[model samples]
Target chain A: MSNKKSSKVGGLNWAKLGTVAAEPATRACYDPTGVAITLEAKDEKASGGEGIVYTVPGKPGFLVKVYKRETLENPSKANAIRERIEAMCENRACQAMKGLAWPLMPVYGDASRKNLIGFAMRACKGMPFSSLFNGPASVKEKFPAWNRRQLAQTAVNFVKRVRLLAESNVLVNDFNPANFWVDEQCNVSFIDVDSFQIADRRGRPLVTHTYFASHTAPELLASPSALNRPRTVEHVAFSAALVAFQLLMCGYHPYSYQGVPDGGGCGSPDENLRAGRCPLGIGADCRLPDCWYKLWSQLTGKLKNAFITTFRNGHSAPAMRTPLGDLEFALNGLLITMAKDADPDRVSLNPCKVKSHEWIQTPAAPRSFMPRPAYPSRGFMRTPGFARPPYVPQQQYNPQGYGRFPTPRMGGTTSNFNPNLY
Target chain B: MNNNTNNNINNTLGNLDVMNPAPRCPVTILLDVSGSMSGQPISELNAAVAQFVRETQADEAASMSVELEIITFGSTADVVQPFTSMASVTPPAPFVAGGMTLMGAALSLAERDLAARRELYRAQGVSSYRPWIVLMTDGRPGDNWEPVAKRLRAEAERGKFMYIGVEIGNSADHATMCQILPTEPGPVKLQGLRFKQFFRWLSDSLKSVSASAVSDQDNIAYPSVASWADLA
Candidate 1:
């Protein structure tokens, strides 16, 4: 959106002409201790609504988010961002910022510091949060080390991160997966520090401009025509709860309903959310996948109550929503139970399938099953008298006289994802 | 059912799951190794294929997720390599260009292979991203290609899989390529023998697609095509 001529922001070339200048203009910045740091604005390959992000040399785990010159032209808006950056930097040692990829230092256009472009933050280099919920195919590829247990742990991590942010009096007004990243170790980091609602000197929270309809609270959706409002604590809690639901429930948006309506209910997810009609909650006719209900049933009574309270009872009343801490506690407990029962060859059963149907679980085989690293697909030598093994498909059986499926025997070869163990 | 029988069934099902690998983004590369590409064009393609394998292997995400396949069309289309992940892929044998292009046969093989792979995924209960069929040619097909083109367009429109066609050089039948290619981008002309660049872009794009979540899969943000080809 920047009309100004694009230059090298980092090593990425973003010039419209697709050519880089041998040397671009350099800007001088100072660390908190007043140590002079020289930064050369290099070409950036990626751009966003705000401005171009440039990688600063000598900074291994940080990137500079430089706003477009047009943004800086608005002195009031520029000053507002600058104030937030300075306050965040001053309180950099706060516990809340520990889990956040908080802004580190503000970058000025010149040594005189008249033109403020953007600030630098710790770069989240791991897989995007989308990887966790996208599908099993991607999850298997990118985070090969992750399993269902890790996913549960990731949800807890997000809750903890948000809790820490709230403790520091920061409100993550605009919450969505796009702003988060999860590493192979299941550690979650939040990006886009600039958009966080900061408290003004007068103790008033800044207005939140961004909104994701899927993740937005019903109350906020009801007032669609309203201008950006200061996000309330209840609003933050609703967003956190939705995120927790999405992560814990295998990426199902809390308001996403299944089954065709009888032409009387809210039409789409956005409409359902705005009208506060949660199909999963009380008096709703919609049905979810049997697996979803099974997953929900496995949750501790308290956790189930919390969801009902937030999505059903608190659909209209902001004050009636389940507290974020309570939700975090329940999620943390579930993940702990998952960690205790994590097994590589364990079969994670989905209730969506018929009881007689085979439950699928892929075992973590040794690397021997895989050929050696280099060109393994080739060089297969067939020795004399070597015959291919006969393929025998697994047989599906149903007992002739058994009227009902027998309950799975626990501690035998069959084990299920029991959420109540926590 | 008895407890022992239940356990037995669960164990058998568990083993099936173990044998069933992760969901794969199957990519079938249909190459035109006909007589016209016997010299530099064939060599560039060979080198580019090698580069594609190497680069794809280097990518941590793509190496494990993307299943690569090679089907070359000459006098007849032959599946030189069945679908295999880059993790296990062998360095392909250098192509020897000689016979007439059997592009129709190559497309037929691609469609068959993709359909079979999807069936396998379904049987295993393994979720999959949409499959990709990349067709590269320098000339018109010796056999009928209309039926295959119609099927490809229909399937692509239904969001079943992605079909990409690229003409190798100026001698390529551009009109035929347009008629056969799916997707709005249509068939593109490779800038010179920029096969290496084209393959690199393909690998990178696959990496991005493979990394995205299921809900976001439909809106794939592909890497820039400007680096390798011009849209025709």
Candidate 2:
């Protein structure tokens, strides 16, 4: 769950896709021509950055996209990504996976320009999670309680879906109330998989060093250890957040996060104890719910022997960071405890059924255990015609940030993935 | 969701391109066969053509998607390969050089060939990228090439073709090469034996496009011509 509102209150040019379009003399290659000729386009003014989005227009339920460049309102790669996803649509597991995915669209990229343009299929039926929560209907009214039994089943099924994905090593970054659309009985599908999952390479020199870096798991971006490790420190963090989100939407919190993005890279408690803004700068306004915050603080030292102690009480600094191996166990333990303590009447939220050995897994290597590789000199880290620094270029893209975060567009924009009008 | 919705959208409004889509790309090769390019230059150029053919053939996506052709002129004009598939193209053994320059004829051939190829690609069930017309010359085109040069400018004004020119050797005047090639205007040069590097970069880029899902090409780095270009 990314912070509801980054609460940071900063805005960057949403119309800056033209930054890479500086004038050049006749260039040698067909810069962006390969992808430019195919857009079946529409514009999402709020987020479309004055660019166009071409969809597989007729296929209502198939794809939706965001354009990264201007010349290509439409591109050939849209069909390609649709084809690949279609190919991967085998088995119930994959089907379920697809159901929750912010589908990957293939893009014909025009990389000849300094900034590459991307093309993909446009999804027509979905909206962003943020929109759903803020929509006109209250949560309870929009979803009338279907007698007690149905509620329990909904929760169980939801947990089952998330747990399976976790077991499969497929982690969803932000999985909370608004991210997925839940029908009356909780039948669900995901939308807005984020640029992280939707990014297209389009066969050109598509190595975007700065591509959606801001959309990454927060901890990875801040870690100096990542310089040498160069490993995915993000997946585990994102997954834990996913677990926390699952619990929160189901009426619980694994621990307590009144902060933005409920369970994100708070790093160590010592790091976050007296925060001006979370390192993630989750924001000053969001505070953890009282109960969880009390428990967290007490477990650290404020209260008598609390059950919420992290792996580091008197241990070392590296041991203090939530190791990936224990992250799942910690989250699962919290969920199990939450469910156990909750009224048994909560049927709709029973998303998991613990098999005794569920929490067993091999311990992963810690950042301290493995040294990261030396980074290239800033000069050598060149993308010849590229302008941005790649991968979440600046923190401006914080999903909860005022301007950079997703916002609702006009109703008739014909977009399936709006941030929701609530 | 259903084929009917697809048909309706494609047929009713401005949405047909969404469904019955085709990948579009136009590829051109500019060859330099000036007196200075007599020996290894031409052999390597031809060899690179063969290489381009094999590479494109292996790349199922590119051969099927891009419209490719070649234009070469030294003393006179020539269409070495009409808009054809690298898969089916049989490059000539080699182009041994002789004559005085006639880039005007080469550009003339390129302009004509690109128009024809673009039409052919659209007609043959494939959409196309902007057409590329490369002009490679060792010295300068014989005859006052200004008229043909004017012709290139007109075509470019209409976005009909993307033209490139190359200047090679000490005999080639930088100011004059700049005039004919127009780094700011008409053509992209291969510098010297850098024809190999230029073509290789081109083939690599096309190959990448052929394999890409997003038919939209972002910026493709041409083989760094900096290495071989004779910096004045």
Candidate 3:
């Protein structure tokens, strides 16, 4: 019998379809194209530090982000969002944003819908990027069929998105795990559209303040006015590499190590990241499973060189960072190699299988015990100049040497076959 | 004999080479199941603890790293469940309250258990985050709690672990609690039976802690206490 106890907790209760739904709050959103979009609220389950996310009743794949009453109180911030919406509406859709949750239109509370407070965008439909590192259970629950291979594919998708964004003259100022969602298919969507760095009407950067400490470039973090500085493509590449490391390495952060610092070495992950302490290079004290080390050893020299340059050799200099395209090429090659090794029928066969007998078989003739090159002694061997003395006839030629010394009386059990030869 | 000796040496070295310990975070829950908590409180506490376990088990990051234990204080303090992975923990059954609260003994046991687990982690060469101690009560301590309180204060001061004290209802002795718990944001008086919300916050905090490089204590971003409790 198990000693475990079952505790009673309330189970999830979803409203039945037959139940009447509550009257939803409705608003009309306008685009610069002179088209108006009506949005009816359904239910809100996701509340972030900035605003509450409500599902649109009519749109199955879209959601509306309404800024909290407090966030709109600041006029400058509100006007910046308004200008961003106008720009997005005027510009042609970028191809890189195919799988992203880009903003669609401006939303307002009043009937005129002229004052912009929130915007409508494609809703994120999967687990947050944090779930990748969360553990096997969470990954199993959220992305049932996803494995490390799938995770790497998701990371590759992220790299592709960043590359496209760069081509479109846009920058993801804040590229942390929390701002992205991934599905089981390795598809990715970027959230928090307001944080993207884009040009306003005056061609000035619309937003700043995206240096998340863990993923931020060391140079950016060291800058005195990091909040005001515009993020560069190098910064985006740095963050992307960090995410790639997690995806490929089962959620281990690039800087996580297992030893105490010596004099000037880094003592923590953040410190190690800032100090360029990569376990594959300067941070040799970091420990990983033997299999991971083996996998890393098999990587192409070019890929390994790129990792070293990005994380260890050129970590401090933003200009030395590997471009997203280069990283994608290396990762693609790695995935191919891993896939080849993952073939189910690839079994390694051992060549040796010789089972020894329980007892040794010695030679029939007594004189055969003498050591010879072709027949080495099976058990203990005597040293040179330490051979045993030979036996002589005990009886003085009494026809049969006293019948071989009367075949000495012994126990009933005796084997004629030698017991010391294979 | 030579082959046998070589085999023994190889076996020992292989064990060492294969040792790959994962980082763990130990959490000790010291609960008060006194006579005052017989009715709605015990049920709610049980439900909340169950929710905490379920949620932690669901979070892959927390499940892999977080270890949970439960120490209940009723007439006598006893560890209902020893330290185990959050993914494998059995939630506590609702207790029928009976005697005086042995909060001191429970805290003492919690401290010892947490210390022993930390040592075990060290012996296994597993890096670990600082542990967490959660004390919840609806009444005053039946035994003297000053000594254990001092030990806990020292532990918290050294950043050895995170300590949080919770008062269930109006019957709690706030004055004694303030003295017994860590003073840097001491005991919190729960707003009704918001145990689920409080545990949800705890689960989120631990999930974040497990996911990050949590060597610096200041890096922890606590979910706001205003959502569930107020400072005593």
Q: Which candidate number maximizes lDDT?
A: 1
**What ranges in model 3 sit over 4 Å off?**
A1-42, A112-114, A124-127, A135-149, A201-203, A262-268, A282-295, A339-422, B1-26, B55-66, B116-131, B157-160, B191-197, B200-232
True contacts kept of 2: 0.00
True contacts kept of each: 0.00, 0.00, 0.05
Docking class of 3: incorrect
Error of 1 at B111 (Å): 3.7
Candidate 2: list runs displaced more than 4 Å. A1-422, B1-22, B122-125, B157-160, B182-192, B208-223
TM, chain A, every candidate: 0.69, 0.41, 0.66
* B207-227 per-residue lDDT for model 3 (tens digits): 877765543334553455556
Which candidate do you rate higher for DockQ, 2 or 3?
3
Writing each residue's lDDT as its tens digit, candidate 2 over B1-232 gives: 1111111211211111211122445666757676767778777777777776776666544654555666566665555656654444566557768776666666655555555554443333233444555556667656556766676666654545445555555555445555554333433334556656666656655665543322123333222334433323
Ranking of all predicted structures according to TM-score, beginning with the best and ending with the worst: 3, 1, 2
What TM value does model 3 have?
0.71
| Per-residue lDDT of candidate 3, residues A1-422 (tens digit) | 00011111111011111132322366455543545666555466455545667777667878777776556667877776677776765545641355576777767755466677677777776777866554333455666666556765787788778766655556777766767788777888888766777765566665566445667777766655865776666677778888776665545566654344453222445666766665653224455334434334444334554565566534665555566677777677656755886432111111022112112121122222232221111122234477533322111111222333223232232463211111
Ordered list by lDDT, greatest first = 1, 3, 2
In terms of TM-score, which candidate is strongest? 3
